[model samples]
Target: MPTTTGMKGGGYYDANSREQRSASQIFLPWLEAAIADLPEPPPHQQSWNLLDIGSSEGANAIYTTERLITALRENSDLPIWALFDDLPTNDFNQMFLNLFPTGKSVIPANDVYTAAIGGSAFGRLVPPASLHVATTFNAIGFFETRPIAVLPGFILPMRPNPQAPREGVQVSEDELIPFQKQAHQDLCHFYRARAAELAPGGKLLVQIFGRNETHSTGHGICDVLSDALLDFVEADMLPRFFYENFIFPASYRNTAELIAPIESERELASAFRIEQVEARDVPVPFNDAFTANEDRAAWAKSYTGFLRAFTEPVLAAALPDGLPQENTIEKIYHRIDRLLQDYPDRYEFHFISIATLLTRL
Candidate 1:
């Protein structure tokens, strides 16, 4: 349960998790397979335990948990006890309110039990071998704490290549290495924790934003925000160092990075068996909608809203301390929107989503 976007107000993710929907669509088939391939539980098993890590306000969980229950019924009619874990700051009230029309656990016919757990996903949330199936979305890669002070300059995670940048120098070698190591450590923690929580042969299905290649991560919207912040510096509205010192939280893993920890370490190597690892090219939400509705203005608005939901918390954390958060957040999005309107296609989101299916051993 990593800290979700937007620290203060709740519901940013619930309202604007467009990317999650798109990513989940791409992962639907795999999700089906993961559930279908689950090892049949022992005879007379009366109850099943399911965990939804980083379950933000319940829209995704309500649907995903239902899907899981439906699949589970195929094997046995045992009622499921679903645990939705997230940070304490999350809107659990909205979550349960949305699920139970009568504010009760029994969902008419489904009969699946549900509850909420609040904490960091980096640490263990449940007792060992307690969960039968675990699912997480867009929640991996975030460390409970900022590992170190932000790199000398740059508010977001910027890994400049060894080569030259046409406008300026890339993030130096010292800055690049630490950034990557921190991400790896965070990911290891995530895998190790899940390994312990899941029952032997339990299923784990997840969709994490990642890079396909080693050179760069899938920074579809992040780089755009970085450039937009730099534009503010150029426009003299915001200072240069604010742009320079902005360090974004979370990691974006590549395929190689994803496998390295599992294959290299003996204990972790034996923790789980990977069934599928897919690197999908996620078209920005508006780009796909634009082809259908064909409204540039509408597309621009959707794109801005998507970025605002997903990145606003990071933006808030990056801003200079004591700045007017509400107003400044608006200005940042407004500037980004203006840039998009000025040149409609100048920037298209470059996103690569990684979906993995593993069975805990």
Candidate 2:
């Protein structure tokens, strides 16, 4: 199976991405403010390019880009070309359909042209100095490749499982240094790549699941999944190696980690000027509804479906090649469903997000 960092496709991500959409919406004002600050393109420039780097299935991206086009039009009639980019393995067909919902350019009336590019954003995918604005939402947490083969007892390197069988074998702070280094490296590479793509004075907005002083993203959801995987291992339904080797291909960085590269790296500091860096816990829609109605069953399913949309792709890819992938995925998610339903309080997810707005120098 091809290693993929993209979300689950077939319209699933777009359908079940309420949490992501909510978190992304929190930054819209910041994005608009950044757009307002954008310097007008040179006199010879033909059009402005707005790019979404990790636009999975293009639902949220389409809406966000349309708003951006509308915002830009308020100032100038610059024809805007909006680009949605993700992994080559991502469901580009679904993205395109969403990009042009009426079998034609939905935003043609606004002079907004849309297209999808399939590639890794960690590498340069667009012409140098050609982009005007770029945004990456809930995607920078993912590693370009699996950093480690085995992370005993926990899928997320930062969050340890207290109920793990090999208690002390769980990942430790000292062991996480390498992973921290990897996160730094990944961020730096991403910045360098965007630096090459964006014009001077271009705006870049980046938002990803993150950790704050008190809260971290995927708290309840990942913990429950880890417990379920441990249960599978104990039942001999899955080999111990599978449990140890399986890891969510993402990392949640704190505020310090998120801005370290620009603060410390000479090249990054010179290439971009940081406008804002903030981290906070965004409200979860299902969590809010559950808080009001106390509907365990509905909340459980909603939470699981939301998690599965972004996580199942990585989990399914990690299964042993000969195994029944679909059956295994079904079993794993079913267990998560049951666990959430039974002990709803055990997994209250927190959506901690870190966002930064920067301008190319």
Indicate which candidate wins on lDDT. Answer: 2
Worst 10 residues of 1 by lDDT: 160-169
Question: In candidate 2, what residue range of length 10 has the lowest lDDT sum?
Answer: 160-169
lDDT tens per residue, model 2, 135-172: 99988788876665456757787856343233434677
Q: Residue 28 lDDT in model 1?
A: 60
**Number of backbone clashes in candidate 1:** 9
TM-score of model number 1: 0.88
Q: Return the top candidate by TM-score.
A: 2
Which residue pairs show collisions in model 1? Answer: 1-121, 154-244, 154-245, 154-246, 155-245, 155-246, 155-247, 156-246, 220-350
What's the lDDT for all of these models?
Answer: 0.70, 0.82
Runs off by more than 4 Å, candidate 2: 1-5, 161-169, 321-326
**Model 2 CA lDDT for position 27:** 84
Candidate 1 global CA lDDT score: 0.70
Question: What is the Cα-based lDDT of residue 77 in candidate 2?
Answer: 89
